[model samples]
Target: MVLCELKQQLDELLALSDGYAYCNQEVGRLACVQGQQEAELTALHTSIEAQNQKLLASTLARVQKEGAIRKGLEQHQQKLVAQDGQAEVLKQQLAASNLARESLSTTVTTALKKLALATSTQAQRVDSVEERLASLVERQRECEVQPPPGWATYLERNAVSLVALAVAVFTLGLNLLG
Candidate 1:
């Protein structure tokens, strides 16, 4: 009976050892799973950080580009403003020049009218003087052709007076022409 009891006790010990071995195997497998999960979590964090860096860099670059565009637009606007001012000045200058030209043209027209009137008056005066001179010459010729009985002595005495009269008429005509 003692031998049978000892055999039964040995069988119980073997069973307990088998259970402990199984528990240890399960613990080792669970540790391996935990390590794999940690590695996956670390890789996921690294990927997220890389994406965030790319996004930040792109955002910065975009902001710089927008700022440059805004600055260029401002400069262009300034240039347009300056050009507008210059155009206004040019418009004013053009208006002044037109007014001056009109005034000058009016002056020239008035001067031309006065000159034409003076020329017409002068021409009439010259014609009247020429007609008077021609009549005097005709009278002198008629008197010379038919002298009366005392005409010879009278002509000799009045010859100097007649010559003076002719010279005066010629001088008067020249003065009028000038």
Candidate 2:
């Protein structure tokens, strides 16, 4: 019975190790995704800021140049119209970037929640397994010091030798299985 329980615990340990490895891999992947999203969001904000500055400069230039030049008012108006179109285009791009940022933020949040849950669940399982192993070890010690009623032959001197040989063989078999 002890050997079977040991084998079961070993199997559980193996499975837990595999799950731990998989969780680590998923956490790494999520981290990479978050990093990439942050970089992209930062770059988008930079682009938006630069475009706003450019728009402001162009507006100021148009105001100053409009008053200074009268002979080519028609050409100035055409240039103003072109600048207005570019500004509109930049506004649309900024809106799209904001939308993309929101979507990525949601994805990152969900991934973080899932990773946290998986980590906690694995920790709980590990703790439970450790408790079970500790209990088993304590029980083994008790059995060795005072054999159970079913093992009453332990009171005989020759039975001690037989029981010791059996234990040695069991341990050897367990080692081989392990």
Candidate 3:
């Protein structure tokens, strides 16, 4: 009975030793798997950090471009305002020029009318003077064609006096014109 008890104790000790060895092997396999998972997580973190840096750089560039576009729009708006002011000034000048042109046209029309009226009056005066000259010439021709009975004796005795009278009549005509 004492030998049977010692053999049973030896069997129990061998079974415990086998269980400890199996547990140690399982722990080592789990540790290797954990190490592999940790290495993959580190690689993923590195990729995420690089992507974030790229995104930050892209955002900064976009912001700068937006600021430049806004400044350009503001400058263009200011130029448009200045051009609008110039257009208004040009419109006013055009209006003033139109008014001046109308005034000049009116003045010219009035002057032309007065000139036509004066020309008509001068033509009528010339016609009257010409008719009077015709009548005087007719009278002088009649005088030359017929002489009175006493005229021949008077002309023969006063030829110089007749010449002087003719000169006096011509001088009177010039004085009347003045």
Candidate 4:
């Protein structure tokens, strides 16, 4: 019964280990995805800032030109509108990414919690199994030192007598057959 329980506990521990491994893998994957999204967002922000700087420089240059000033103003307005649209799109993407990141974070936290619980349970089971095994080993050692009831007496008395009786019976049978 103890051995069966130990085997069951071992199986449970193996299953928990597998679950922990899977959770860790999922956490890594989510982290990678989050990092990639953050990098992309940073790149987009940098590009937008660079574009704004260029627009400001171009506007200043056009302000000094007499005939090109009005045309430049119109073009600048159009560029600003396009930039606004791009900013809105970026805002939407950022919001979406933020939501996704939050969701992934929650999932990772839950998985980590489950993994921790499973690990703790497995440790407790191992300790229990170890204790039981130790006790059984001690009992086995004690049994080896202590013989069972009448074992030595039975062996000593019966051994020689049984051998002599067998020898006599064999001799008698052989003489009769001859």
Clashes of each: 0, 0, 0, 0
Candidate 3 TM-score over all chains jointly? 0.42
Q: State the lDDT of candidate 4 residue by residue for 1-178, as single tens digits.
A: 4347546655665665576566556555655655665576567557656755665565455444423644544555566668865555555545665565567556556755755675576566556655655665565555456433343544464567557767878999999999
What are the lDDT figures for the candidates, one per model?
0.59, 0.57, 0.59, 0.58
Which TM-score value belongs to model 4?
A: 0.38
Predicted structure with the largest TM-score when compared to the true one: 3
TM-score of 1: 0.39
Q: In candidate 2, residue 37 scores what lDDT?
A: 56
What are the models' TM-scores?
A: 0.39, 0.38, 0.42, 0.38
Q: Pull out the clashing pairs in model 3.
A: none
- Model 4 steric clash total: 0
Tell me the tens digit of each residue's lDDT in model 1 across 33-146. Answer: 556655765675576567556655755675575566556555655665678755555555456655655665565567557556755765665566556556655655554464
Give every collision pair in model 4. Answer: none
Residue 2 Cα positional deviation in candidate 2, in Å, after optimal superposition:
36
Q: Answer with 2 or 3, whichever has the higher lDDT.
A: 3
